[model samples]
Target: MELAQRVQSLTPSSTLAITAKAKALKAEGHDVIGLGAGEPDFNTPNHIIEAAKRSMDEGLTKYTPSGGIPALKSAIIDKMQKDQNLTYNQDQVIVTTGAKHALFTLFQVLLNKKDEVIVPAPYWVSYPEQIKLAEGNPIVVQTKEEQQFKLTPEQLEQSITERTKAVIINSPSNPTGMMYSKEELQAIGEICLKHDILIVSDEIYEKLIYTEEKHISIAQLSDSLFNQTIIINGVSKSHSMTGWRIGYALGQAKIIKAMTNLASHSTSNPTSISQYGALAAYNGSDQDIEEMRSAFSDRLEKLYSWIVDIPGIHCEKPKGAFYLFPNVKQAAALCGYDQVDDWVTALLDEEKVALVPGSGFGSPENVRLSYATSLDQLEEAANRIKHFIEKHKG
Candidate 1:
């Protein structure tokens, strides 16, 4: 059977593969401790669940506007004003199936064949694949761990070209969990503005920050940057609503309209019930977010110390998000593996602990472990990792 070239060229999700392998082992009666799943372990908040139930009881289950329900969009608009101090009318926002879907659709509308999107290394696993699917080239610019895995403005300026359509900025980044400060974002935003490149800011982890560092949208830096920027965010991370499938983009009305049209043909609208649930998420109390963020922070602090204490392991403390990315190249060498991926596989096989090899995130010398689980699980996983390294270290 023949498949489309675009589909054929797509890179399979390494995170999902690792997670599935862990699940398979657990099903076979191995005591697998998975540290690869990227979501919070918390259940959806009861109020949001009740809101969905109420919506269903009130017959809000029918088709909504392709972009989203008007009320939900209004909620989103209000959220932007209150949280980020950015103002947007309803026309500038489009809600989609998820932030991932929102990004995919944005690429489809924004990219022409052979055009390029600048992606920083250690990116979310889906970014490059989605760019490929849209017939765009993903130009990966590798960031150094010494610089906290952030793409510098100089690096951004060097990577841009006439074919460059946009650059992705995922603050409180996914695999690395590091954020760019406002000064850094200002510098990068200026570069993008000068080159007339779109600033695609993915703020999915904005509410999960553990440090005093605030998540600032590059779009909010100035009027010029705001006009050229597209903000992609959702309730998935912030509100423990990952399964609800509600994510959105805020940008100029023209791009938002094009994206809404694309979505009308594609997903038709985000789940109607889910939109109502997200409305509650945006308008309701933020107690749930505070609680979840606190849990992740506590886990991150404790687990990071344990991870850094491991022999031959080095990790930068993350400011936000729930993952710990540790440079384990020395550990891999000491354990007699040529690649960190192999070391990750051996750890899972021997110690029944699952971690995502950083090769998938464009950094082969590291590994990403989610502290989204309980402290007990993190402690146990750390002990197992320590033991594994000790047993194999030569």
Candidate 2:
């Protein structure tokens, strides 16, 4: 049997593969400590969960508008206004299965065959694959770790071409957890306006910042940029609602309408319960959000110190998100391995500590270790990692 060419071009998710191997090791009675999580270890807030239950109890379990229920759309609108001072109508938003699904849907509606989308390297693993699945070309520009793994205005200017349609900017980035500052965004936005390219601003990790610096959307830099940018975000990262599967896109009504039309035939509507839960998430108190963010901050500080203390291992402290991306190439070299991925494999085998290799995220020298676990687990994982490096070092 022949697979579709698009499916053939798709790369399997390394995150899931590592997770499966870790699970298998655990089942075999090994004390495996997996650090590949992409979701919060916390449960969804009680209020949000209660709201979902009340909605079902009131018989609101039926399908909703393909874009989203109006109340939920209004809640999302209020969130943007309160958080980013950006406003949008119900028609300008479409709730999808998840933020990942929202991104996948946006690419489907926005791209033509061979249309190019600029992706910064060390990107979220899904970005390139989703672009290719939509028959669009992903133009990945490698970013420097010294620059906090951020894309520069100079790099963005050089990467644009006639075929360029859009570029993705994931702030409070996934693997690296670095964010773009307001001035940096303004510079990047100007280049986009100059080149007449679309800005795909992904702010799903907006509420998880660990630093004094705030998250800035490229859209809010100016009116023109706001119009030129499409914002993709969701309750997943912010509200500890990963399993709820509610994410959305905000932009021009025309683009939202087209995406809605495509979604109507596809997912029809995001799960009705998830939308209600998200509505409560936006409408309720933010105490839970702050508590979760604080926990991540503590983990970031402690785990980072432990990771960098290992021989030949170096890491830059991330400002947001729950992952620490450490440069392990020198460690791998010291261990007599040519590839960091192989070093990752050896670590899992020898220490029963699982981590996602950086090769999958478009950087071959680093590895992503998620700290979205208890402090005890994080400390134990750090010890095992330090032990592995010490034992294998030349």
lDDT of 2 by residue, 83-135 (tens): 88988888888888999999999999999999999999999999999999999
RMSD of candidate 2 to true structure, Å? 0.7
lDDT of 1 by residue, 46-153 (tens): 999999999999998898999999999999999999988999999999999999999999999999998999999989999999999999999999999899999999
Clashing pairs in 1: none
lDDT of 1 at 78: 96
Error of 1 at 82 (Å): 0.5
lDDT of 2 at 278: 95
Model 1 misplaced stretches (Cα beyond 4 Å): none
